[model samples]
Target chain A: MLIKIKWILFVTVFFMMGISEQADPLPSWNNTNTKRNIINYVENAVNEKSPYYIPEEDRIATFDNDGTLVPEKPLIQILFSIEKVKEMAESDKSLLEKQPFKAIVTGDNEYLKTANEDEVISLTLKTLTNISERQLREEVKDFVFKTTYPHLNKTIDKIVYKPQIELIKYLQKNKFKVYICSGGTVDFMRGMSKELYGIDSENVIGSSNKYSYNEATGEMILEPELNSYNDGREKAANIALIIGKAPVISVGNVGAGGDIYMLRYSQNGNKNYKTLQVLINHDDDKREFKYGEKNNISLNWADKYKWNVVSMKNDWKEIF
Target chain B: MLIKIKWILFVTVFFMMGISEQADPLPSWNNTNTKRNIINYVENAVNEKSPYYIPEEDRIATFDNDGTLVPEKPLIQILFSIEKVKEMAESDKSLLEKQPFKAIVTGDNEYLKTANEDEVISLTLKTLTNISERQLREEVKDFVFKTTYPHLNKTIDKIVYKPQIELIKYLQKNKFKVYICSGGTVDFMRGMSKELYGIDSENVIGSSNKYSYNEATGEMILEPELNSYNDGREKAANIALIIGKAPVISVGNVGAGGDIYMLRYSQNGNKNYKTLQVLINHDDDKREFKYGEKNNISLNWADKYKWNVVSMKNDWKEIF
Candidate 1:
């Protein structure tokens, strides 16, 4: 009778605790307005009685990748290209004879800081990476696994913000279709999307390279040309074209005004459901890198639009 | 006691019948090798012990629209553009004065028959369609639900091939990710894909028009210019560039050499799983339209490649 009474008491206590406690959807987030706002928005969205109620199909979320999801300190794609350019220089020798390639090969760091997209494309296509996508994807996967960002000790995949990932999962749990809208090449991002962001390759929209298909071998050769450069206004346009739906929630970081258009596009006042727009303000140099565009256009836009600005120092309890 | 005995016997018989019977996946498809091949391939693919086992991530299946799913006749997109052109001409009066618009508006049947894509673009952009994608998509949905194809009394959505739809659903039931790599406009197709083929807007890859984003309102205005014309060789390239994974199963119809490249692309011998390539042949004039490319390019290629040539007359028990 004593043993049975003890077991009953334990079961009752456990049941009461289970019923009393509401689990945190975003545990990595600190108890700030940024966290509170996100939680409140999601709660209202899933509640049919709430005015902010969003149906499953309308819960579209678009996230910018490079700085928002991972550290973009000088952009990760450029680093990937630079590594390939150096490897090619050892064999070709003629690569060092070119302008952008020469700058990269000779360690002209000052020149590279101001290198244009055309120069970067030339470095990528002319020196390396115009082969079949299957082959290039293998190389990208190898690089991502082996790579460490400058001043960072962790592998590329581990550099993602813990709070942002929690937010993505929270939104997904409420039936949101989350898409990564990045300015990086779609081919490059697709190689790591499944592993890095828990996002499928098809759900990632990015800058694309024109491809040439070989009818005989059925090999898809990545052409030496830009099909679409997914950035700024183009990001929003690509979302409209590919996804064919306006995102109710958008997350981006401050950089070269790259995300302003996409953020503005999301909050464009067409939505029947209440929306959330998160701008990650990289102000914590101790935990993560501290940087923004020199012009401050994106931050200004975020301010003007009243989008939620997440301070890395205040909003996150942990940064991966 | 007699009633109880009868109930027991009935239950035993029903249990025996349920255990003995296996469901037919593609009922619209007659007992042919094509159906057998599809079933066998998917069975082996999902079976972990089989050599053809494909993981969920790698179970990619791509399908073509147009004649593959719905009748391409004069091409449904062209007909849609014609309808818009006619509507605009009625209000403006000046729209009937242009070259291709005049050709369409004046009912110059010969000119329209020979009208190329540029002429079609001129007719579409000049007369109409330089509006927001949201508004344009609404018009497309209205057309799909209300309008009928030429000589077909049914609405556009009702005219989809039942056998193909059955095949798509069968693939889905076996954990395959099915995508529609159509030559239609992505915006136009997104409007009716769910109703017509049970495809989501994001899963339908197609020809795209350049779009301009409205920063103030987030309205994506459909530009008059062509972005990517997803047909022929481009179909295969677009599949690679967008989906980023080689399809293990591809379904397309013979019209031009359009389906040939995509079919070949699917069977490129790069996968671990056994693949299925289906070439739909429109050789039943009595039940449906009978047509093939004049050059016989697609049929000859299918013969050379030894792909499954599904004769519309012999293979299908039903058309729609």
Candidate 2:
């Protein structure tokens, strides 16, 4: 009888362990304090009977795309824009004579960098505005798929952090609403977000240009009108405008200008909403590149706001 | 005994009627089908035991500011931009000689209209980028406070729809995460979003520009770099990037490009999240100006996507 009872107990324990493993919040993440804390927060908030239970409506989460999700060592979008200028210059003989286009085609990063942001914006507008919205969509889609990140030697989509991707899914599983707010063009995000992050195009909000339907051509054309810049405080405003409510939980990496704004938005304690503002401090050097404390905006914000800083070096058991 | 029983019955009936009145959603709104449906849907979704009960995380909502929330009759932002340009042109004589600035100072709407979107964008960037971010923020804040809508003869904030404001507060009360996602600039939105909509700056997402901090000047500066246009697919991408999840319910007027994208983003159902897309179609000539049809991108999107179209003429009991 004792032997039989022991066998049953062992089987029951084994099954429970299997179930717990399956339910691990950060499966891709190595066992680390950062991952553990994140998981614990979600677990506490998601528990229906827990005092910290956040209603599903308030479970809004935000992330920065560029350096946080994918490798930003070579500046992906800028590189793409440069390559586009090169390609366009080859075909359009007039482009070679144009000042900015000529500079870009000649592989002049210094000149391009010195060129005022307005000039770069103007050039981008000129390059992109001539096409129909449909065409632009297709073009961006093709570019994302075809272009590979120079450092990673992989497509931009493929270069996304594996662990972060799992975190997004895990958040969703726990009834958290996740969003990607970037400074990239909304169209480009629409093309890539679904495949890469399982986020729909509409759920992605970013910087934008003016658009109008051409009556003569009967095509939806994107105009090169400078409308709005979704950065810093604007990033916060965009979140409020587009999301319609303040998020209880906001997550972002350093250098994201809008992180402070997000923290402020979440900190407004009204009703049952509890705000958790977390900043991912990239400090790892071996498995992943790290930079902050010098020119990093998020670090400055974290220090100023006293936000929950998750160091990659201290927080993670593994880096992906 | 009979007289006492009669008194008790009357009191009970009066108490029940009062409770019913309080329970009615948007009682000031006309008994329109759209209004009724919206109220019913929200009611059903809020009940914990209901199958349609949306968890707080998925109960994300979005709103458009211009026509939907505030009176956009004179196009407030455009007028402010024009006035700023005029002031700058007058103060700096050189601006008067510049093409777009000169045209703006002269009140040459015809010239302004004649210039392509690129030219307008270039002009806007040039005028705005020359100042520090702090200066720009203050300038915009003062402009919003001082400026009045011409026809209404009221402050822009006062011109916001009372009913819509109530709706925002109501959503907040119910724990729905709300955000304002506009086609307007992030800086512009930040200046007024909190005051007007009770949405904090961080929750607002809109169009943006590339900004950097100048250590030498000890100030944050905005560059007129055209980074991305946050419209259509871009709006959706921004939502995904910033919010990090699909919104279950999205609200907007016909002019909101982000709204259309939000609907699309939520509808793909890639992650098994349910979405409700509501379009505030302006058909009421008496209360609000009406525009858009098959030609309008947003309207076309609604029809193509089969979204819940709430006509102002038939949907609401009241305009404000």
Candidate 3:
């Protein structure tokens, strides 16, 4: 009787171990309709026998960097630009007299905030000029490592949305080649891409400035000339050029105006496989900021196009 | 006594098996100084205890596609251009009267052989125009799959140098991410990169034309605008922009004018690890073409720069 009891306990323990080994791919994601849809889509797409099955080679998933993967309440690039101006101002006092630099130096946040897109681009280019490509990368790496997200009080690498991280892992497990198609500088994103999102430098496509190689000095110098501005329709074009194939799954935050093009491109690919477009909506003001324009655009687009939109407040059980 | 003999035999077999398992990384090459240097470099770079050891993430190896990987006696793009013109002329006889089209249609091989670089580029652009990016890829795939090398009487895919193939595999075994930074179209290279060289699409950087996404038609149209010409110095710049790191090992054919820049860029990276630049020399007239200009250029450059030059006849045991 003692031997039989011990054997029964051993069998129970072994069965439980087997069950635990097959743990959830996305534990942070609540068992909501959004989660169910994603699981079903992945199952049908990856399963060999399914009609909508996609080959492992074609399993490409692209995610927007800023708002989709991590919180971008105060855009990181803007912060970096501000820091660059301040750092430059310490050495060159004449920079304080420049229009955008002057606006930033005088603490005119309102004017800087309402500054035109070209003005912001000019400021970024001005600050980053005369530095080698390697130096620029080092600077970005230092900023990413040293700075902390204002609300989270965690380093830039630590402020990633837990649910999205799980999704990236899940996609990777299913042999999906995950890429970050961000509007951020490719150089900057590449610095922390591996650390923050588990995506490699090769897989990060973003806005870029041209760099020239000086044959005489054997030096690679970064030019202020904008090679690619990876935003809006350009994002889709850049993805096509770089990745060679359109993504099967695209994830973007609703508030990011540039991501819609990439999401549409993903859905527009080969019709043999069922494509997925996930738009993350930050509606939870307590945990995250709720922006009006982007939210309105996302709601209207999702409704009209019948795309999946995850409400942060309702769909998410927790937010980090 | 029988049991003792059996135990001895078992030990002998196990010992032999262990020895066989640690076979040479590159067996196709003859036992030469070049082969030994490559083996030594890989060993030092991969061994953690070695002072020159590089991390797995930073172990990048780049190779030129055309002449370095496979024979380019009949340049691939020229052949592709000829094929495209012939295919297009079937539908529109008017194309036969066009400047480059006439030269191709009349089978004026001498004209094509002596044609300037810009003329060749123009012809290529003309042939590749007016097709969707997907259609262009399918066309190239069809061509690559169907065509055979004249000398070897084997398919183009099977005509790769055995020694180089082994080298690529050996590098991969050492945790090196090998890329094909080709002068060919990125789309065309990507189609064969995986099957031919065991490289994925993302790692195949090449010349490319602009592509526009047509929203109304829901199609991606390949525009005539040249996005990037991934050759010469542009190769190094493209590698920097795309891969975000200089490669540890750079392999190129001495005859290919564009590869020297990429090879230099690879060696110019981090100084902690010993960098390698291998220039393939087509000095064997019996096995391959011995073009005077390219051969001389490679010999001079390799000598001047102290880059390793692997002679086809002397260094390699066998060709494809």
Candidate 4:
């Protein structure tokens, strides 16, 4: 009887050690404060007796797609628009007579660099629409799967920051429903969301064009109208209008003023769960890439709010 | 040994019968094709062996709030809007000088009775905005909880169509995520969705005003601008934009052209799980109200599509 009890204790201890060895949710992340903060937050969030415990229904975590999830110096959506414009110009040469369309088709974006909101919108409509949403999505699908990134020499899907994807899955495993809230078009991001990030189309939120559906064919056609161009304040506002609840974990990067408002929205006066704000800082040009916004607005918000900033060089042990 | 085996078999049969006896999901509906169709669709949807099996992630069900889920003679939202307008006038007598506001203040809606779309929108902006979304939601909450129905002699919450609530719960029991797609403002419906219909705020979708957030306070202030006024074809269009997936089951009513497009949106060329379209016909004037659209558009669509039309008096054995 004594021998059996001792053998049972030995096996249990070995089993626990084996389980812990395989339980690193973010293996790609270095043993830095960034990784520790995320794991600790999730652990406390799922603990029923913890003050930071969030009910499963309220555990929403939103992520910014470009810059945060993948490379954004040349946004994937921008490349998609360029290819679409080139396709349109091939059929109708008159499209090349315009400023932005001509600039895009001829590979000169000097005019686009200084374009105002209205000028940019005109280009978006010319390139992104005058077709059904289904067709636009198909075009994007082809581009993402076929095209290779310039410097990375790999497809966008194969190189979506390994650490971010792991973080999303980790949150999902702990009962958090993750959403992609980006400045990219809804259908544009949706084209690659499922296969790339394991997020379904239903959970992806972004800017979209107003649609007209055919009763006979049931295809939703995109019109030359802006539905909502989400960035900065629109990001938080649209979340209020759509998701109806404030997210508890909001992740973005410090490239621009892209995600400061969303992070603020998540942390603003939230008394339930201890909200987490993660700002990914690109600091490794050797491994991946490095850049910053024109202004220090995003970094300022991160500083004032005491947000966790993950340095790519120090915090990410791997880069896809 | 044979006698003991026979006793065990008898007990097993009795246990199977007890499970079936407790498995009636929709008890408020009388035996009819309406109830039968819903049960059949759910059964096949959840059964993996069936060709009509919808993967759990794709089991989205959207419900139109007015006339479909609850009463709509004097829509709950309309009543709430009127009360807000009145309160606004009482606070600032200057607001009573306008045409619609003046008419409303004097208890004479002569001007509003034939007001055009822009004029109605002007009123919507005035009553629904110039305040934070949170403040407007609080106002709606107060109105829904305190107001009494005119002829029903019961508060709206106390009488929300018991059969419809049962149907919602039944679908939820089978792993369907239900959402409220209503012409009412998202904030307006969100206020009472949980208490009255058992739907969370995040599951409610509706028209909304644009919002601007106060960086200091984090309050999302509603702007006078209309973000998306969802009605007619816009309902389906907005759903496609917001929800990103076409609903397999869409429920609406025939009171007006309020839901024909959404019903069509659900069934249009869907080759997946057998899509179900339900049109609740408010035929019982003694029990509920009776009404129809100006034209036969809704009923004609229902007839052409062979959508299930629930007769409020005949199909419902009970109403809340």
Candidate 5:
């Protein structure tokens, strides 16, 4: 009996020590004042006895995926989608004769870039609709697993910033519900978010295509109809419609239409709602490409609004 | 001297009495329970002295315009946009012969309803592009000022619920910056949001069209290209990009996507943003058309997400 009790005590102590010694996934994060400030703020709000202690229900966090998590210097997703379109065109030679697909296959990036948003959308729809939903999901899964960022030479999924992932885990550990609020396609993101970010499909809100359930077939069918682009204030509306809760914390990189709406929804006065707006400024070029306020409308708006801009150059101690 | 002193005292007493006579905006709100709970939560998060108090830089707020602020029953904007299309088609006889324009000119509500989302969008683009941006803005403005809701018989803008408007004012009074985050067209909302909701053009975030600046002519031209539709998680991105801050509070109605993203963004561990996700559920058939989870995705998502559903059946003492 004495030996058993001693052994139990030793095991407990070892476990506790092991847990304490576990390194943060983002160890490169400098022990800077900014990091300390953020940690302190979280601690205060989470302490139940503290006046600032917020209940778990109010602890909601949102993060943008592009540029914020994954690199988007040369329009990463667009490139990938275009590549997928090319592959589809190659498989089905009929698509090779189409206007947009023809342009794409010929390596006419300039013409594709110059195409209006609607034209590009139409092309995307035509290309994406070539496959069934199940097939598309499988294809996306395969692509995500194998595809690597050309510049980083890392698997696209692995290109996510370690610090941001840590931030997400930390928030989740503190009972804050985290969501990936992105501009990417809803189905596409839904397919990968759980595996990539540990966020469930229901929690991952995004742009959607109109879908219908065929009563006779008893199968969900994707319609070639654009319902609404998840951008700008629509982003806010989608948030309200889907999340059904005002968030206390919001984070994003780009100042596109969606980010603005998220901030508006998060900050608008109502009962029991609080928010922290953060813009992840991409200023690191060594690890990631850097672009600021040249033609990026969202980035320009962030500066003009004097938001709490987190400089990748200064604030973050580590890149992806 | 005695007469003067008496007069002064009487005047002072009268003023004090007058001040006390003023009614509280929300007098029926239970002071020490639900109402106080809300106020305390907001105060704690907003007050800089408190540990939970978010700095002013982080205090972002977003509001949805359609059914949330104005009447959406029958979709007034869609109707107006359709009307504008018809009017334009009158001059452009060629458009009258086109597939979508031909359909619009028929004025068959059933046919229009049967039209797919793509068909509706294509028709709208054709009609809208018939006129210049300036002309389109003027036409929409004129329609808004002149038209009244068929059921309410009140000017469409006046159909705004007085209580919600008061809430907007209340938020502004408390130093919270507000924005109109809607799924409506950005230009259309920008034309009227300032006058109707006291939200500025810069603060209005919504679905948008790609525009071009004619440097040679010194004119900004609206292109027919649809850029991004502001919906779902995109709403969250818009908030972050435009507002450059996360909100401590978010107010939305059924169909507004702002709530989902707002709630998620509000729960950042670093920011400790609190959220009051209020859903303005329309259930009064007498004042406004009742709309909820009957057949709409918004209502369905709201129910599934367990949002703070504010039913018109229970919460509101009055409707516009």
Candidate 6:
């Protein structure tokens, strides 16, 4: 009887201990080698006893916003600018006669579709300028809240990757200061970054337009001049300028060519800094559309640099 | 006896409570109206029941670095630039033939003194350009630690106003995020901001030179182009771009006319924001040299705007 009681007690204690010890940090991630590697790296970096431990103040993580955090096939800013132009054309019919404005407002999807990425960006900027900073923010808020992602059949806020969201939380919980280093305008992302990813507006570093304070009107107005194009090597430069530190972790999707420099910069940080470069490969055709052969640059760079590639089909258990 | 014991206990508890409640937040400040008002404003700002209560995240405070934080008799950047130019002249003798380099290296202080502020600034830029970002930082660090204030006979780090330091601590304890918004270069200020003000490098926003990445050397080099001059209205613009919000409190010393726009911007923030503009009057000739009639712009603005004035002679118990 004594032996039977002791055996039952031992089994109960061990089971509870096992449950306590196996807490999932990244629940949305699958039980794969990639997930295990991420968990192991985080554990070592956060462990005080480990030689790879980074102090909390120095634990900076930067993520590319559009493709990495949310779906960008129909880019957020492009949609936002188109809607804004349409709204403005309602009041002033003559604006539709302009070059970029006409392209966006005339239901002339062909003009925008046939144009290169730079032309599309120019069209967006033309639509966004000539407004007070306050008005721009209000317009973006309205669009972000009301619009839906066509393919996903969900709201823009609901379209963020479940695994990436989990990763952000995991990094934040480990005392890392997470920043959104994006190619979009700072004012555009400032509207919904906090709502979508728990990122503060100040931590969102991005491209900017020339903004001047009007002494007569006491208003901050946005001008058409492009102050910065925060892409390619400029992303790293802006990170150094704004954040004033080398990030320990850089996360981005593979489709864009911009995030390569940022990732390489992170890898080449201080020798004592143990860095991680996570490139998300959109390979799950059934879930998220696969960009096959479109990410050759990122793939080649990853192969050369030995960067960790997170396959959407294999690593992520679910994609929103 | 029981009644007597109860009365003694009540008196003892009340005495201890009095001591705790009366602890001065700014001990380095004198018992003047300015000191009293500062305490009262902070108390109300932090009080949850008060209409002026600001949330911790929104409690941002910006301070000018030059005259406000450290003495800027010979502007901190000018002194730093001169020393850097002198050091560079040692390696490259050809640099001595340059306009600013000749003036600084030959100790022709008259050129800097006689020249207008803008001309002096132009000279400084000429001397500071064309160096790697790493080299600039290394040079700034060497100069900051070794240099001393001529008048005060103390190292630059030791010359920061004691009362201002106390005020910073008081504001920080009340959960205000302090930032140094200076007219100096971002790279130069980033070197010692952490040591001097307990401010992180990220929180130090300042003027910047255009920078480019060298692919071959893997270096970020400073180009000769002026990226942004963070002074006057430009200060407010940079604050909006970098900080992404208006500061609740703006503190600057009355010597130069640069801080006027920043103070006005803080005051013109959200209607319900409850902002405070503090202008430190350099009126103490005994402890610190008096800038008598030179700060007319700031003085006039403060008078018209009803900004709080911290009189150095009457308000502060110590200067350095």
Number of the top candidate by lDDT? Answer: 4
| Maximum-DockQ candidate | 4
TM-score of chain B of 5: 0.80
Question: lDDT tens digits, residues B99-164, model 2?
Answer: 767767887866533443234345557666756545665677787777776656766656777767
Candidate 1 colliding pairs = none
What is the docking quality class of candidate 5?
incorrect
lDDT of 6 by residue, A1-320 (tens): 99999999999999987875456777788888888877888888899999889998788999998778887666778777777778889999999788678867766766533443355357556777777776777777777878987677887878889888889988888988999998888888888887778887778898888888765555567889888888888888888788777788999778767788888877874446788989988788898777734558888988898889999899988887
Per-candidate iRMS values, in order, are 1.8, 9.4, 1.9, 1.3, 15.1, 1.6
What does candidate 1's lDDT look like per residue over A1-320, in tens digits? 99999999999999887764445777788888988888898888889999888887778899998779987765677888888788888898887898677877778777545554445545566644457877777778888888987678888877888888888877887888889998887878887877777888778888877889986776788787788888888888988888777788999997667888888888983456567889988989999888777899988888888999999988899988
Model 1 regions more than 4 Å off: A1-22, A111-122, A125-128, B1-22, B108-128
Better of 1 and 2 by TM-score: 1
lDDT of each: 0.81, 0.66, 0.79, 0.82, 0.62, 0.80
- Worst lDDT 10-window in candidate 3 chain A: A112-121
lDDT of 2 at A38: 78
lDDT of 1 by residue, B159-274 (tens): 88999999888888888889998877778778788777777777888877798998776688878788888888888888887777779898888886677888888888345557
Sort the candidates on lDDT, descending order.
Answer: 4, 1, 6, 3, 2, 5
Off by over 4 Å in 4: A1-18, A21-23, A108-122, A269-271, B1-17, B20-23, B96-99, B102-122, B269-271
Give me the overall lDDT of model 1. 0.81
Model 3, backbone clash pairs (residues 3+ apart or across chains), number: 0
Sort the predicted structures by DockQ, highest score first. 4, 1, 6, 3, 2, 5
Taking chain A by itself, what TM-score does each prediction score? 0.91, 0.84, 0.90, 0.91, 0.82, 0.89
Better of 1 and 2 by DockQ: 1
- Candidate 3 pairs with clashing backbones: none
Residue B44 shift from truth in candidate 4, angstroms: 0.8
Question: How much is the lDDT of residue A264 in candidate 6?
Answer: 81
TM-score of model 1's chain A, to 2 decimals? 0.91
Write candidate 5's Cα lDDT for B192-256 as tens digits. Answer: 77677777554677766654433233223456777556665566555544343455676677643
Off by over 4 Å in 2: A1-320, B1-21, B109-123, B132-134, B215-219, B255-259, B269-273, B293-297
Per-residue CA lDDT of model 4 for B1-320, tens digit only, reads 99999999999999988876556678899889888899999999999999899999889999998888888766677667677789888889998888667777787644434333344445678787778777777777777778897678887677698999999998898899999998877888888898888898878888778888776887788788888777778889888887777899999988768788898988982545589999998889888887776787888988989999899889999978
